[model samples]
Target: MYSGRVRPGGAPGVHELARLVVMKGVVGPLATNVYVLRDRFSGDELLIDAGAAPDRVLALAGDGPLRYLVTTHRHPDHWGALAAVAAAAPDAVTVAHEADAPAIPVPTALAVSGDGDRLTFGDVSVELIHLAGHTPGGLAVLYDDPTGPPHLWTGDSLFPGGVGKTHSAADFTSLLDDVEAKLFDRLPDETWVYPGHGDDTTLGAERPHLAAWRARGW
Candidate 1:
């Protein structure tokens, strides 16, 4: 269960996953979450959402080869440290959704569109699920761990309560629709959620409240 999982409020920690060593840290005024996933066998690491505090983020990555730097959306808070991280780890391939790529300051070397687009770093397979609404190109990163339950990294698109805040009802509808069809409907209850900010939650924990979330219209 997630009871043992790190809530990540102000403290930095590491998640010893089956195939990867996930170094999770907090950064910036917004206190966004940054993850350094190192492939257990290959030692290749992938940094997710270099939110802010480049030095701290780089420190979490350590002196080594960072393979990929991926931004989950176009939100400034999510990519505030993107450029800095990219420059520091020039060898790391940068990735983001094609729709949000242009808005990101640094040029994304790999632009992925959500139709079965996947990235591999050692044995870990990263799946990109486009979930709009929080932003025009919000994404939910899924890692189907072969050894255990699937792990999901939902930027701002998802949290324990409902979908991320949308500017309009239409945007909310779009986000909810994509989240249901692409996320809740397909993923199992055991899927672990790593949100952009705040504590982590599983699909099972949030599934029953879907209707309530929809009714709230947020």
Candidate 2:
């Protein structure tokens, strides 16, 4: 179990939003990221991507209720622990995009679509941004804190060096276009991106590389 104020190697540390505390840890053989978002006021928590080691993931929730178990996408590595975690927290609602719901291993209570659909717990609200192409239902969560820059939880759609890998040239183009228009075009440079795996990066760090990524064809 990992518990600390910061992750090593300069990845994003524990971030305090307006009313939430965010912590991240690597889980599963694929090293998928599992993020715990705790509402400081209500002690309610949301677990993002229960990829592996259900016991370890559940332990991270502490004494608060696990209100939501969110699967960023339908990939096996991203929801490998969903069954176990959902069984443990029966009250927690399972969430995923409607298009990807059929592919998920567990039953999802909330099949969300469109952009700006909000899920609130206590005073914290997370908005869903639809970013298709990586998958038909690819999505990223946007945490808009009144006091800090927005935090984006991009599943595998957007990453540090480039967008997620696609099955074809058309898919790659689609992923890149959606990412540029929905994320980079709309959010500020200071927006922090926490991808499904690996280190975190900011929109500013990736903005200049758009053309390079386009030329490389993913």
Candidate 3:
């Protein structure tokens, strides 16, 4: 039975999920986290945020049947390895929201996904939350699987110590408001946040920092 649920402490019971590998990207001179979630039971896998260092990502991927390369936004740092990934996993479909589709350099098998979209492979499913403050088409993948910690892949939107920057006035204001309401205000105290950069943190740990960041007018 599907037993995924958002739990306290950001930790979910993930024993049945097979395995998850956190691949650190090398390009952009920034630490980009690429998640490779596999259905240990069936050997099928899905890649989330194929950023930097194609060779590292491929080596970590290790010749598995990749189901798809899902991007979090159109940013180069987040999708830098798209062409390489697509070339290596020729059959894998690349999914992204319509808003960021054109900006993505490579030819994408583009599937339109927005808020509440559910992506699943082998029994693992993640609820897509549209967090637009970081970028016009930015998205945070929220997973409430029964087997692991409840995770919010905040792609440059929300972070451990701060929020994403907006290049325009409209983008910035709207993003700040969105983060306050859609993200910070909605998640449970224990939600584990995996942002586009830096180390991971929990909702409880970040809530106070959110207040501090808001005060900075960032």
The candidate scoring highest on TM-score is 1
Arranged by TM-score, best first: 1, 2, 3
Better of 1 and 3 by TM-score: 1
Tell me, by lDDT, which candidate is best.
Answer: 1
Candidate 1 per-residue lDDT over residues 1-218, each given as its tens digit: 22324443455677788787777788888878888888888888888899998988999899657988989998888999989899988889999999999999889999987657787887678888899888888877888888988888899999988899899999999999999999899999999888888777899999999999889996
What is each predicted model's overall lDDT from 0 to 1?
A: 0.86, 0.85, 0.70
lDDT of 2 at 120: 81
- Scanning candidate 1 in windows of ten residues, the lowest lDDT window is 1-10
State the local distance difference test value for candidate 1.
0.86
Estimate the TM-score for candidate 2.
0.92
Clashes of each: 0, 0, 10
- 1 or 2: which has the higher TM-score? 1
Q: What is the lDDT of candidate 2?
A: 0.85
lDDT string for model 2 (1-218, tens) is: 22222332234346666688887877777878888899998998888899987876777777768888888888999999999999998999999999999999798899997777888876788998888888988889998778888889999998889999899888898889999999999999999888998878889999999999999995
In candidate 2, which residue pairs clash? none
Judged by whole-model lDDT over C-alpha atoms, candidate 3 comes out at 0.70
List the candidate numbers ranked by lDDT, top first.
1, 2, 3
lDDT of 1 at 213: 89
